[model samples]
Target: MKKNIFLVLMGILSVVSHVCAQSLPQETSQSIGIIEFVLKNSKYEDTKCDIHSCQMKSKDGGVSLTLTHATMKQDKEEDLHYLLKINVQGTLFSTKVEVRYRNDPSKQTMKTGKRSDEVDSSYKTEHRVLRSWIQFIKDSTTSKS
Candidate 1:
């Protein structure tokens, strides 16, 4: 029957999609205390903090971060604000980090001029800034022996 055939195809598609799904990759480091130390000594303005997590924002308020997890996924509306998640899990001797921007920041461009279509660069985009912040933390954490 047509209904039976459709059901079978749908089931197969679901199985394939599930099998292909994967969690975002995390960056690991051998130093455990470095993450906390770097965070405490960070140059950025500390908006909030607690035992396991912290929220930081730039002085200009152009970029904000709440330490947390995953990968970036774009939304239907690009103009709306989005939450960028960066997760850090630490153990006695090591740490792991994963960043996720709910609304893909890479797709969001910056306007250069008064014209709507006029765009400058992605350097100032949310994604770039997030990546920079992650790299800074990693560099600062790992570089210290």
Candidate 2:
């Protein structure tokens, strides 16, 4: 009987330890800072104006930028995806930029929906622009101040 109790107690302890071994939340403010920095230096035009809704622009001259909404996805992995809209504007023309970044890497593909007239017209252009945005993000670390 004592042996059985010991085994049971050991099992309980093992389970408790296992549960306790689970990773804790590792998020930090630094990541947010990196994101902000990246967005600022993304090389899109109009890097200064805060248009809030409808109109969006990045300070860089390469792509227009706007952040619609953001949320933390519930998953085993520590990750987040941001809904971003980009507009490649020029002297007389413009294109759309729409994509999401998972865990800060733009290479990760995300499911994007059709553009609405209510949404920024710049975000309605082409899917290929996502790659450009990703490229800009990947190169961002080098230009950090």
Candidate 3:
């Protein structure tokens, strides 16, 4: 009975906590600007992008947005409750994220695997903000002939 009760409480807590995280629109202009900046400044090898977009996959058949700073804010939302501040070492910058329990203030769960670089190896949860930027670049670019 004790074990069952403990598990039930933990489950309820998890749900409650998750319900509090926050998420913004996936295609916001602010997101696009950040993605463009990272892609242009990262020097990630053969990446071609302006302040507006990035190119398709490289000839090497791989894409990596290595961050060069430590925890840059990708969104302008003031109520950063569980904002996930991530810092990578390669694509663009290297930095840490300001996340609580691996969720944004509104607990936006990142389901995509496009830009999930963890600066620290001990982390298990991936940041979706980064991935969203990466996807934006890919989606905006025109295919080469």
Clashes of each: 3, 9, 30
Q: Taking the tens digit of each residue's C-alpha lDDT, what string does model 2 give over 3-51?
A: 9999999999998998665422223123223334455555443333232
- Candidate 2's error at 108, in angstroms? 6.7
Range of the 10 consecutive residues with the lowest summed lDDT in candidate 2? 117-126
lDDT of 1 by residue, 1-145 (tens): 9999999999999988875542111221112124435444435553564443446654444344564332222344434233334333333332233343333345422221221121122323333444455555444334542
The models' CA-based lDDT, in order, is 0.40, 0.43, 0.38
Per-residue lDDT over 105-125 for candidate 3, one digit per residue giving the tens place of the 0 to 100 score? 223332222433222221112
Off by over 4 Å in 3: 1-44, 56-59, 64-124, 128-145
Model 3 whole-model lDDT (C-alpha atoms): 0.38
The TM-score values for the models, in the order shown, are 0.24, 0.30, 0.21
Most TM-score-accurate candidate:
2
Best of the two (1, 3) by TM-score: 1
